[model samples]
Target: MEILKKSQSGSFESSDIIILIEPVEPNSGRNIDIDSSVMLEYGDTIKALITSKLDSYNISDIHLIAKDKGALELTINARLETAIKRACNIQKATMH
Candidate 1:
């Protein structure tokens, strides 16, 4: 996302959204925190997608941080969407 400013303590402006990626730790029975790239788009599609997905999955605590890479408008959005879904185990499990 176009970060006009950065916050060190998870403090974001009205224009920014925070995503938390919480995955269960194997054998440890604990959760791991992961961050996603910030999404940059004029529209609210990215935020909407992330909000819906996060709510649907009921994930918490894990923090996500995203940095734009000059992707197509939808590229970053799609990437984040894919990343979240995959991280939440909604996507088909693949061997890679």
Candidate 2:
């Protein structure tokens, strides 16, 4: 889904991550930045996870800022997905 506006998810709490995303010009490519307490140990891993998640959504033109506080993979996944949904103007899933 296309990013309609800037959106954020998660928190600065321990073992959590905050994901902030902003819309960029079409076809401009992704600008994924990472800030983590474990940067020296898992920087590449975090970047890969974020890149894979963005790719899954086919989001090529966005500026994503991931601030991590030693969160696990699952948390990262969830936060990023939630941020994407919010940026796309989705409040919640609809049920039929």
Candidate 3:
């Protein structure tokens, strides 16, 4: 999983799960639904989903910084996956 250059820090560790969250408006994308806007209070739900998705991997440390663009749960998930893949340096996953 340490395929990419160790970001400014050192080797990636799975024990570390860094999460940064920011608030955003709604209607940022076509895939995003306004009803899912309940993410404000349900942010932990998104975190849990992403964590679950990354749980099976060999990633020891994960640093997830999210910029909410008024998107829904699905959009958030897509963006998070993109970020994680980018962090791990998966060349093919960067097609986004």
Residue 81 lDDT, candidate 3, scale 0-100: 54
Candidate 3 lDDT for residue 64:
39
Ranking by lDDT: 2, 3, 1
List, residue by residue over 1-96, the lDDT tens digit for candidate 3.
Answer: 432432222112332223232222232211212122344776677556666655644444444353333455565555555555655666482343
In candidate 2, stretches whose alpha carbon ends up further than 4 angstroms from where it belongs are 94-96
- Clash count, one per candidate: 6, 0, 6
What TM-score goes with each of the models?
Answer: 0.38, 0.92, 0.49
In the range 1-96, model 2's lDDT, one tens digit per residue, is 689999999999999999999999998888888999999999999999998998898888899999999999999999988899888887686321
- Note the residue pairs that clash in candidate 1: 1-38, 35-64, 36-65, 37-66, 38-66, 38-67
Model 1 deviation from the true structure expressed as Cα RMSD, one decimal place: 11.4
- Model 1, position 16, has a per-residue lDDT of 37
Off by over 4 Å in 3: 3-40, 93-96
lDDT of 3: 0.43
Q: Order the candidates by TM-score, highest first — what do you get? A: 2, 3, 1
List the candidate 1 regions with Cα displacement exceeding 4 Å. Answer: 1-61, 93-96
